[model samples]
Target: MKAFITLVFITVTLATYAQTKYSNEFMNIGVDAAALGMSNAVTASTKDVNAGYWNPAGLVNLEDRQLALMHSSYFANIANYDYAAFAMPLDDRSAFGISLIRFAVDDILDTTQLIDDQGNVNYDRISLFSTADYGLTFSYARKLPVQGLNYGVNAKVIRRIIGDFANSWGFGFDAAIQFKTDNNWEFGVMARDITTTFNSWSYDEEAFERVQNAVEGQNQELPETTEITIPKLQLGVAKTYTFHYDYTLRAELDLNMRFAQNNDIISTSFASINPALGFEFGYIDMIYLRGGVGNFQNELQIDNSESLSFQPSFGLGFKYNGIHVDYAFTDIGDQSVALYSNVFSLKLDFSIFR
Candidate 1:
């Protein structure tokens, strides 16, 4: 019972904090090992099914039906993240895509009933529950008459659940544009939650009564039930080069911008910007190696001194007969603050059937 009360307090505190900053953060964790390997720097050069989550405008480049799946674990496997997406060209210059993402922590012990009404400790009274977040995105992209420009939009629905105790639903929209230059340079812009996302929460009062009674004057009232996610933007540029006839190299840089100042490398009262860089090397378009560095932040050390930290990721990919298998070693934060996780993803190009 004590543990359960503590958990409730922590959950409520985190929930309140999230309402003002980093709301719906799971959606930003990203999908596809190929992008994660590049520390999420593929905004300008993403041209596959995974583009639905990165920069949907790139989907217009698809020539055939594509399906992608990815799975990754975080926090020492305490949490699991999964993604699936499908995309197909609608015509010579248009495309459509759909994608789903889920992040969850399952089988958490419910200690609220550790003790019976008679004050008797009963081991069998414990139960389990899960907390999860889900996002569904519908995307559309079309090539514009202006030379190499393409534009896309996404309608997203979000669901959040906390073991039947609480739940919330949200909706948002995103817009993006991708342009390719005659000189092989690509530029992309993604505006996430452009109109702002809103989540309305509902809690079961009966289910929360236990938490209310667990402490005096603590959690006595339900938490605020509304959360707002502000708009964010990403700008990217990429270029690819081919040498030795069969060797190809691609490099991309992205600037992720947030409306409010934070820990990003470039911080201001109006906006904060974080830069990411990624590189991919391909041999005969079959075997590939990738690397990236991003998520730069200033950390306060034990002695109150500030130090710069960043995350580095590496990945490998293989392609054969329209099948692509990729693996990535990524760290959400500096090695000292977080552990590296292994991610695997698969992509299938249906054109192989033809």
Candidate 2:
């Protein structure tokens, strides 16, 4: 079994050189600290609101109504990402949830080449604008007729805006299945953007043309209306062990692949495959520690050297009286600490108090 797992990891790591490009890449950026700390390998794990985004089927594992909110500074503090979710069990066999994700960059300087009567340059007239992306998700999950199996789906609405000059609207759906065994093993499969999410873009032609003309040999303009997203599949497996019924440990692995056409220099759709590994230690169900590694890929170094990817993450969590707080830190490549990101999340369980 260990050999098989090792082989799979090696295969995924080798394929990491290829990266997928899709609309709303921010959607793939993890929102929950616990999940992010674990390198986003939570498809088969449960008991948290993050499941609404990772694998809806895991919602069935939630034991109480929950409200969760998270925030993170991304990419050298140039942007901010925020997420909020609410989940409640509809009955003994079903659950319902909703979540919102937003990524935004503020105070961007929108500059245009300016010429006075004498063709002089003016740098003081630069205007500021912002770009934002949003996703709203509605989810439902239920226990299947067969024991230990669950299924769920997420319906999503997406929006993107660039300083009032361009904007887009999109819609997509995601589905997942999870199964658990009596021996503390769990498996999950999630099909993200199952129907090929689409985004219709509208741009101010006049403004767009001005920007296009300013750049030399720039002819690739966004379409006025079209689909912008592609489908992806993620599979996960996990196992849990208990020590004297007080201390518990869980290990998980996940594989993610995109099935859409990639037109980049590396045209193989298989190049987008990625693998992740994670571990969690829990104490009395009140405190937790997590570590993970993922986002493996290839990039060009400052000297045009081949550089491999390395992303490590760790997190700490505490729960008290129905409230949970989590903190996580993740390194962004080989850059200094300034390139790293911090994630913080808070969760409240109403049922826990009841």
Candidate 3:
């Protein structure tokens, strides 16, 4: 039974890769508890090391060398995700950042050997393998001549591996801009995979043969080896309000747009747009609370009725002397799927050591 299930899993995974949509999805899962807690609505307001992933243009706001780390588990602990980032000012007008991300499912039982050549069940032959994806990003940001304006770009490399069965390599680029007004209003835009990322895959023939033989006539041939990811755009607006001298509140809204039509809130032949809203409350810039809602979708019910669904997230944060600790209770999918996960992240300023 276990071997059969593993075969089915591999078949489904390969099949999904044939489609262009949602390719390299692990990279979109996001990083940092604070950003995830805000449903990734920080494109216009991010300013720390995490900006290397969110909106590199915001890196211009960094005043000191910074480092960040985060970890989270998904699908009831069946998968794990990890992220790390570092950013520093190159001068008064330019900044540089680098980030790394990994998502993996480990210790999967490779039950191909569960049955001996004599067709007898033998648990002793079972082995373990893992499937993992990795991303490395290099980002650069610079202040423009126009006051309160900045531009940034990212060069990314992608790696994917399925134990000893298959592996792939990919490359992509991203561009972004951020602007701040004297009235405290902020705006930002980001273009992901602006050059259309491409992944080329290679398979181990012997291992693939085992997969094909496991399911008669089902996996008769190798799957498509090339995958493409199109461009995606995000636009954001934000503002901060101060109540008295110690209390503050920040609100942000973002529109995530994809060229192909889908189940998003606003869908058309040309594009689909999903809107996200987030808010943060701070006291003396030390303690914080955050909340957000996003991922709007239209789903068909069992009775053939249509319904709307969304994902909600909340978070808490504390900062003292350049150290920040954040926690978020969030859902990766919509309410219908209910894949909730706990995320934690830490950020530090190198200036603290000096």
Best by lDDT: 3
Per-residue lDDT, model 1, residue 115, is: 73
- CA displacement after TM-score superposition, residue 50 of candidate 2 (Å): 1.5
Q: Cα deviation in Å at residue 137, candidate 1?
A: 0.2
Give the Å shift of residue 2 in candidate 2: 54
Report the C-alpha lDDT of model 1 over 103-188, residue by residue, as the tens digit: 99998877776777788888797788888999999999999999999999999999998885788999999999999999899999
Higher-scoring candidate on TM-score, 1 or 2? 1
Give the per-residue lDDT of model 2 (tens digit) for 136-216.
999999999998999999999999887756777999999999999899899999999988888877777766654555444
Please, what is the whole-model Cα lDDT of each candidate in the order they appear? 0.90, 0.79, 0.92
Evaluate residue 303 in candidate 2 and report its C-alpha lDDT on the 0 to 100 scale.
Answer: 95
Candidate 1 segments exceeding 4 Å error: 1-10, 13-22, 215-217
Off by over 4 Å in 2: 1-21, 113-125, 213-224, 260-272, 298-307, 331-338
Candidate 3 structure quality by residue, lDDT tens digits, 154-219: 999999999888999999999999999999999999999999899999989898777777765775
Ranking by TM-score: 3, 1, 2
What TM-score should be assigned to candidate 1? 0.96
lDDT of 2: 0.79
* Better candidate by lDDT, 1 or 2: 1
